[model samples]
Target: MIRVLIVEDEPLIAEAHRTYVQRVTGFVPVGIAHSGRAAMRAVADAAAYGTPIDLVLMDLGLPDTSGLEVAAALTGVTPSPDVIAITSARDVAMVRTAVAHGVVLYLLKPFTFAAFRDKLDHYREFRASLPSNNDTTVSQHEIDRALSALRTTDLRASTPKGVAPQTLDEISRAVRAAPEGVTAADTATNVGVSRITAWRYLEKLAEDGLVTRRSDYGRAGRPKTRYLWKTKHAN
Candidate 1:
């Protein structure tokens, strides 16, 4: 399992991340740090336990110091956990720096669970293929496929070894097949991905003008937002 540390200050967002971690197959949240100082403590404890943290889902907007600064400090460790920026900020310069600091992924905020899970699953695949049998030299073809497939925006070739094409089909079918409209949470459950991944797709659909958002009402609790596929136009 990949041990993940979350360094987000917002309670709701942090809880959402924790929920996503629980839902994924091979991810475990080691701890949460609300501040950079607190983040150091959390990392120290996890490292002291010997497992350390395999990855960190960090928010760029931190209350204490810049998220990049925190990442810089963390990456200075002997064996740094791959940092995945999970923030709403889309500053290009900051992102460039993040890439330089060894961040494997950058996920924009307000994403669907499906998108988030897709990225994590790819990361898992990439890590799993690293010298599983170290006695022999790794083949170039194997290394190429591993790197190509791990990209969040890229799709793995059609095979049972990777995510099947039917998964995306199922998600589209689930939403288009809905009698009315599907909530982000429901779409994720139906697609077998996380809500964040599902939401990311929904956002893409929204941007493309394929799906229109309508506030779902008449339910007790938080009002559900439904993404209805546009019949007249494609998003």
Candidate 2:
């Protein structure tokens, strides 16, 4: 599981964020800290327990300390937690500093559930592409795919002409909602699109490492293509 530590001052908002993390596949909400000091302690405690946090959902404005300072402190720790700033901070200079400290994703406040899910899903793909155990030599394609998965947010940007983003998002949600996976035809039926159109979106997701594609040969003239949602810690 991708263990997450949510750092938000507001109790209601923090609870909502925790719930959101739980709803997503491959992610587990391990703890919530209401301030920067508590967040630091949580990270240390997790490390001491031998199950360090994978990500920190941090808020920029905290009563005690700035989130950026916490992020900078985390950078000095061994096996530091990856940060995704979930705040309303819109200052360009602060954003640049956050990037310098290795914040992987920046999510502005007042985002919808769909937007939040997209960021987490993207992170999952990027994490799955990396070597889980150790540092090792990797091919250029592997490196490129990993980086692209981390940076790419708009699926429409990479789709070939004629594929609509709205339809692609619908197809993605359908596949993700099915734990047992979905076939192209089934996705088409669910999303009210043609099988060919659904297949195109599925193929794109599979290529992007967001979903796993396999062949089902039982009771088939030609083997059927099956796609499943990639689960926790799958590499």
Candidate 3:
């Protein structure tokens, strides 16, 4: 099994990642670190314990230090684990920098479970394509085949029907702006859509693992559903 380490600052998000990692076959979540220092320590401890991490799901924004810095530091580790950047940052420069620091894959924020699984599956295929023995040398064609396994198709194709990307963006922004949480009615008012329409988008977000659903029981009548943006960072 592939030992994995998750480096995310947010407790809820980190837990979600851990759960996702557990669901995938042949992958085990060995540790979770909320900061760069903690991540480095975890890697070191795991290595010392004779179960080194094989993959790292790194979040770019950390409370202590930038994830890129941690990724760079990890390069010095013997039998370095492959890093896959998971972040909300979309800046081209950041992407280039992450690649330079040896990030094998880049997964943007607000992704669905399907997308997340696809990434892990691709990484597994990439590893399978590689030479199993350390002393084995691979040819150019073999190298190309291994790397090709990591390539992902366009994500837009996977989006559910009837969900407009623009409207989804607007709804997501409204939810993120509300620190406490937002109901479908509130989202409808903020995004200039009907309550049902807002609810549909909110449900989609929840299904995608971008936002969380909660029940508001303080009200007099039946409990109302509230949607809380999962990540601290805005996508």
> Given candidate 1, what's the lDDT at residue 122?
66
**Better model by lDDT: candidate 1 vs candidate 3:** 3
Error of 3 at 102 (Å): 0.3
Q: Candidate 1 vs candidate 2: which has greater TM-score?
A: 2
Residue pairs with clashing backbones, model 3: none
Query: In model 2, which residue pairs have backbone atoms overlapping below 3 Å?
Result: none
Q: TM-score for candidate 2, please give it.
A: 0.73
Best by TM-score, which number?
Answer: 2
Model 2 lDDT per residue over 34-90, tens place: 999999999988988899999999998988999988988987666689999988888
lDDT of each: 0.75, 0.86, 0.87
- Superposition error at 66 for model 1 (Å): 1.4
Q: After best superposition, candidate 2 residue 160: deviation in angstroms? A: 15
What is the number of backbone collisions in each predicted candidate, taken in the order shown? 17, 0, 0
